[model samples]
Target: MRDKETRLKRRMEPALTPWSGTTEATDWSLPEDLLQQASRRLSILCVVAAVLWGIGLFIGNSFPPRFAGLNGHPYPWPGNLVGGLAITAAVAMWLYIRLGHARPATLDVGLAFLVVNAFAIGLLDEWAPREVRNRSVSWIAVVILTCAMIAPSTPRKTLFAALVAASMDPIGALIAHLRGVAVPAAAETFIQYWPNYAAAFLAVVPSQVLQRLGRQISRVRDAGSYQLVQRLGGGGMGEVWRAEHRLLARPAAVKIVRPEVLGAASESDVRLITQRFMREAQATAVLGSPHTINVYDFGVTKEGAFYYVMELLVGRDLVSLVRVFCPLPANRAVYLLRQACHSLAEAHSRNLVHRDIKPANIYVCRMGLDYDFIKVLDFGLVKFGDRASTRQNLMTADHVTSGTPAYMAPEIILGNVETDPRADVYALGCVAYWMLTGQLVFQAETPMKMFVEHLHGTPVPPSQRTELPIPRDLEAVVMRCLEKDPQKRPDAAELFQMSCQCKASVPWDHEAAREWWALHLSEFTRGLTLAMPAAPAVSSSPVTR
Candidate 1:
């Protein structure tokens, strides 16, 4: 029977593709958010350039020429025309971004605008009176340096853009000579243009530095056999990343705990945090229940960052489910809670107590032909027999509590050292309350106040808080689990049996789950694409106050 179950589990796992190193190069591509930021910066630069040009035009007309030249120089019509055109172009580019047309090709458009700005500066220089032209550092240098600083791109792309922009100085000089303007000697022109060209050449340094830094960060994100894709979310402890197996191409989620989070902690606290992390990975990996989140691998990176890879879930947690859809029907709540109970039951039978069991920790996802499948997650606070108190003390030493205050059991609040499986049972009951009413069991202004309510206040029944009709039997089971006294609460196994007995008006079944998902999650359902493996299948938030 065990072997048959293992075979079934393997078949249910996500498919993986053959290993390839080709995808690693794709990681260097700038994300859309970063590109958007670059576009905004470029737009701002254009506006600043336009304003500077307007100011220059105002000063030129209002004051006498501040250079050694004849007082009479035919209104400098060429300079005025070039300056006006530069201002117009800068304003147009700014408007282009402000009007919300800066996407799909934002980087390309920004680069083109940057090159135009550089060329305009060079033209303005060439059109200035001969006495003033090439007398000081070129404005083209400033533009090149600023563009390099603001916009990030590939080193090759940056080099090409900078070189093209720099060449505009010589090109402008050529245009001047062709237009009957007597240009300076070649040696003097080179002396004047050298700074602009040098600036352009040096601009690539920042791009190279940024790219090298990005590569280093990518390396740090790389775990044993998986590569971190993007961050899903983060909390006080660490971040969770969407990752994929490097070789097999199987999608997964990686949770990372960097060493810096413990930098301010004392040695003992650091040791406790490390032990807790290891315990979380070790405990979850050994659990045989399919309802529990599967751990595929865990290790420390070369930089001392700890990470663990687990199967990626494609659906929302109960918290989001309630937030989006409001209170769940009693039947559906029971369906999800039963699956969570199964996971808890397995952990409890093995002398493990999941100290944190809130709605956020209970995920409901699609599993092959099955819908509304629940997977229990976040076992970082799991308590083994006899060591529960010591671990709790270390966790609370910094004045921060262990389990979430909203779903914390009375025993945990009272600082009981030997909390049993009933603690998780109480927390699960709180989760049921949330699913039924879309509200916490107790409403308090602060975490401490919430803790006080859990300790001394009576919880309003779930049925009273919401318009949704919760079944009497299920309500009784939830209230039984919420009993302040541990002895009055049913254990995980008993709670599972009790949950199974509750008969809803319309019992949740496979067909009902499928129908519900199709109605509400059609987009996600339609987008699901399972990757096929070329090789044998390998078995795999919460606020801290």
Candidate 2:
């Protein structure tokens, strides 16, 4: 009976509920709406003021003032017309702000200037002595001037404009104090000058605001995405960080924009960097081979910070590997090459060409020697073929010569940006040559000369440089890959299959090589003490990391 009760209680237990996403939505503010409202109000006031001022001019002229001819201007007609327009502007500015429309901050600033000018003219009329064509003290002018200085078409604009307007008062007072006599009309001068100062202020404000916006954008972008554990390193373009995704909790590497490569949040540079970033992600994601780094996700953060999330690789790059080990054992070299070719085959099948194929781009993972994982990195400089021309913006001409010149093909060196799979095959040949000889296929002190050699010169055979026995069949394969004409080069798919066969035959060749080396004992021994200046030992290090 107790066991039956326990079973019934266990069956009643409920499953745990998971979290669901929920957040309030906000609207995007556009500045154009505010401008329209301001313009409409200004037009109405201008029409009313023009008609009233014209009637006043005739009535006042027909009936002479009891006091004098002096008013705001030496000629009363001119003053009346100018004063009317100024007063209208003040009312129009007030109406615009009261309406509370979204508009660019410039229009608000302009409206404040217009209103301030009306008070400035009125004060001039009141302050100037009888000989200077002044009239009566205007109490109304002070109220309008104060309101004009403080009012703006929007809350953000009003606060900033008021502070700016308030600052002008102290400056005007300082100048009056410095001159040793009170300029009784100093406040009026400040009202007149406020617009000019405000114009300058507008120019300075946006930069600081944009910088703040950029920081905020960065914060938003980083929020709940990935956390940077540490910086990896940077290059000509940007820095990379070791990061972790918050949800999946997977290790990833995040790349950030470099200050040198960008000005604060430029739409153009940002777009280009974003494109390159997405291309890297798309290429690696679609390649989807174990030999290629896996891209988890990529996007720009709210803060204008661009980053890509990719599976964190632990192995050292192939460049370091090749440096430690000069020429690898023939069997081992063939095996690694075959794995790389397999990755390349997959990339080619997807219509993608890893133009920047080099030692640094290859990763050799040894944690699993039995399952030796060779990963490729930095498809950042991939050749997007026809897709490039379609872009409205082509920021730089660097793609034509993107990869290490020593490894680039003749077709690429000749400024052929429309490179194809054959260009990649040629780079593959360069890598193979480097592996066999423990040296660059073409030697030059400068990039230009190296490029010229690739375009117009022939590289020495790998066996000649390394003192290794060159099988005629292998030589033919390497030569075909390095063929000057792209058409003559074997496709990566074909070469990948060939590399498979090459690795498989290595076991059989070992037994045969023992006998063959015996017959050519003197020749084989000559390679043992080969003059190796920068030749490192056979490094298990991967070149194309």
Candidate 3:
């Protein structure tokens, strides 16, 4: 019997040899289906976010509690929500981020929808009786549902958000029905409760979020001296992960390029792109300020992927923030621009131009009672003043242009590679224009038209476009950056200094923006947004200059 058992164990040994390690097979590599599901969910969330935000703002601004329009509820920061539905969507957004799962998937669409309708129902304040509040929510749900029907490019998220709003509506209606209102068929009640029930859906919701972040984090292993966490984002080229220093638990961003991309490249080409990518990191990584994201390490993985670690930011991108409350006040605009200039100038000093300087690229780490940390990302489109030929070019990776066309300069569209700091200056001008008006400065009907406008059409200054006060210094800076002539534009470093000098009413020590805005507004007060007591209107002459 012992001999037979030994023989059997010997046969089983080969099977266990491959997976002898601690982690499971799926742990190292994600399943195809899981990836597809995550990707689809992300796409759906994108579509849903676009729709819900558009409607939320419209309903929020158009409805009662009239102050809520545009810059509605007055929530201290950006926009405020007087209605319960808008508040609910905000809560879902809050939950999404805190849990480290702000994917805004189909599930979020449904949750956002529910939150909006629920908010409108007066569930939180309940100014009137429970039944009255419920009825209000039910009515709001109808309006939300109708909007969803008319929306273009409806995805799973849109459907889900609509369903969520619908859930609140039925419950409100049911309460009214219970109070002896001549109700429709009992079939409607059964239908409301069909898919987890609508009459009281909030009871089951509110706290049921699948924060897979912990699960993702737990999967990281403590190898060597340091510990590693879950991966953040990567494309066909590379991946980035969060890691902790062994000695100090300080967090860092670890960027990685998979072996396949590096391993197969010729040594010369590999060195070229590697050097460029590293140069990109070094150029902006060590700005050495809270406003600037700090790069800690840059190295290749055991598998031969190149990686760089930097400061991991917390908070939404400026794009998300603006969608809620846009057309920032001139003083507020100056404050943000000044901080951005500080960082960009540092890059410009090294002759580095951040080609992709869009709202999505700027992250707001902390919105202290009045201040925030803005970290820039995706400098892949960076231009090195002296080094023209990059490893990316050597490989002939793809034919597509490196940067987003919307932000690309006139010189770039004309296929100018010797493009210097002026290209980035154009992008910065575009960003400044966006903040002041909450609209793209060179917006045309199509991408083709947008590109053409950059070549031909003249952008109207912010002062002329919106009600906001436009500082001449700020105006000079934007126009100079957008100058058709590259030499006519100021290098990012010079621009940064100008920004620092232009808005100086507030001391660096004084972080109180409200007081700063109030004081500065009196000097050069320009109103922002389409709402409020309305800021003073200002305009500029059509410039052929």
Candidate 4:
């Protein structure tokens, strides 16, 4: 086991090194949330600036005689044309950013506009008649300060951009002299441009302040001995983060339920949600099966967010597995299903029913030297059969039904408060049908239509839907599990026994699994070796019913 782990680490070193939490790594990485925030701020500023420019041009051109004393000369036609073009450009850029199609390049595009706008302002200042040239407020200064405030960046980067923008005023003065326009003397020039340069230097203060605050928040992301590295994904209830053990250097995934999600509910609803979350953690932690996800620790943050740390697995969930590749062969489907049965068997023995048993919640991972290892995840909707009636009442008080619509059993849709382990058996049969045919048992337009189908529709056999041959015995076992009556469906233990007896032309074993992965999914495995944050492990799919 130690040797296998070492080999796995060595294989993942190239991809993991960039995210190892060093200063250089931090400088290079920019989260998507930050990018979108910067884009939105820049878009708003551009629109405001454009509107003000248009207003100034309209007023000055309309009442030239009244303003003639203010500038000591007529506003030049070239200056007016430059202002018009600038406004048009700004509006175009605003539309691009606001539409959100070019989000990844938004910061780069915004910075380019900032530099160009500063130069345009300098040209307008040069054209301003002598009286107003040096006395007017530095519009360039306002632009620099606003951009610095909105975009979070390293102080060094902010300083560099500021300096570039500030130099435009001096550069503009030189251009005026070359064009034979009367320009200010050297000492007077310094007085005119000093404010812009000063503003440039001061902009770094906000940049440094924001960077420090970001670091402080990162420090506060610790949950017991684990430190969150990056956000993997989030849902309505909470977020999941990629984390590592402080002392052990082991990689893990942490799921957090923030206080605000609970704060929005009434006090009684808060109690019920908190109780359900705690039960999920407790139930998952006690299970001994290797097929079940292993919980390492659970706690609440100082801010009242509930969190649980679990082992990070490396592979795609069943949904991605089928979507990327094709439907599994008869032998391979049986091999994977038997492992899932192992996990369900253990949970059922403890009177636990996994209410959500869709393909997205079942993962196929590479564990140590073993490929195709199954890890059942997301027990958030797990039902305790011993207290089924009372827990069901509490869970459904909000008029929300748990479990995915496509995989829900007939009894669950009918509002049977005492749903048993057989509901999971029915869902597992849906999974088998999906694996063999690459489709759901019933198709419908909405959750209600899906519920109706599960209640009244008869499923087509896997063999009839696919060209690949399925053994008669295996097909019988799947059909038995999909029976509408709870009494007719086999228990998890019996399901496993029946699967083991089914014969296929070829058996799926370790060597076959390894060869298949290397041929079809080698790149995916390497990229996700330290980041299995998909679906229920990080972000969960929305439950329909």
Better of 3 and 4 by lDDT: 4
TM-score (C-alpha, index-matched) for candidate 4: 0.61
Name the regions of candidate 2 deviating beyond 4 angstroms. Answer: 1-224, 247-249, 263-267, 367-371, 385-400, 467-472, 503-545
**Tens digits of per-residue lDDT for model 1, 294-380:** 988776543344567788776778877899888899999999889999999999988788898987788887877789999898888
Scored by CA lDDT, what does every candidate get? 0.74, 0.55, 0.52, 0.74
RMSD of each: 14.6, 16.5, 23.0, 14.7
Worst 10 residues of 2 by lDDT: 17-26
lDDT of 1 at 32: 45
Candidate 4 worst ten-residue window by lDDT: 12-21
Q: Which candidate order results from sorting by lDDT in descending order?
A: 1, 4, 2, 3
> lDDT per residue, candidate 3, 1-545, as tens digits?
45643553353232221112112211223223333344344445435554665565565456646443322132322233343335446455445444545232433344454455454552222222333222322444444433332221123334455456555545544554565554446576446434433423332231112223322332232122335555555544555665666677565555655433443335554554564455545554544545566666554332233455665554446665567566776666666776777777776666566677877676644423433455666665676655554422322234545566677788877766555766877887888887778888777778878889888888888788888777787788887878877889877777777777776443333356444434533322344322211112110100000
In model 3, which runs have C-alpha deviations exceeding 4 angstroms? 1-241, 257-276, 285-291, 367-370, 387-400, 501-509, 514-545
Q: If scored against the real structure, what TM-score would every candidate get?
A: 0.61, 0.53, 0.48, 0.61
Q: In model 1, where do residues sit more than 4 Å from their true spots?
A: 1-221, 261-263, 266-268, 387-400, 531-545
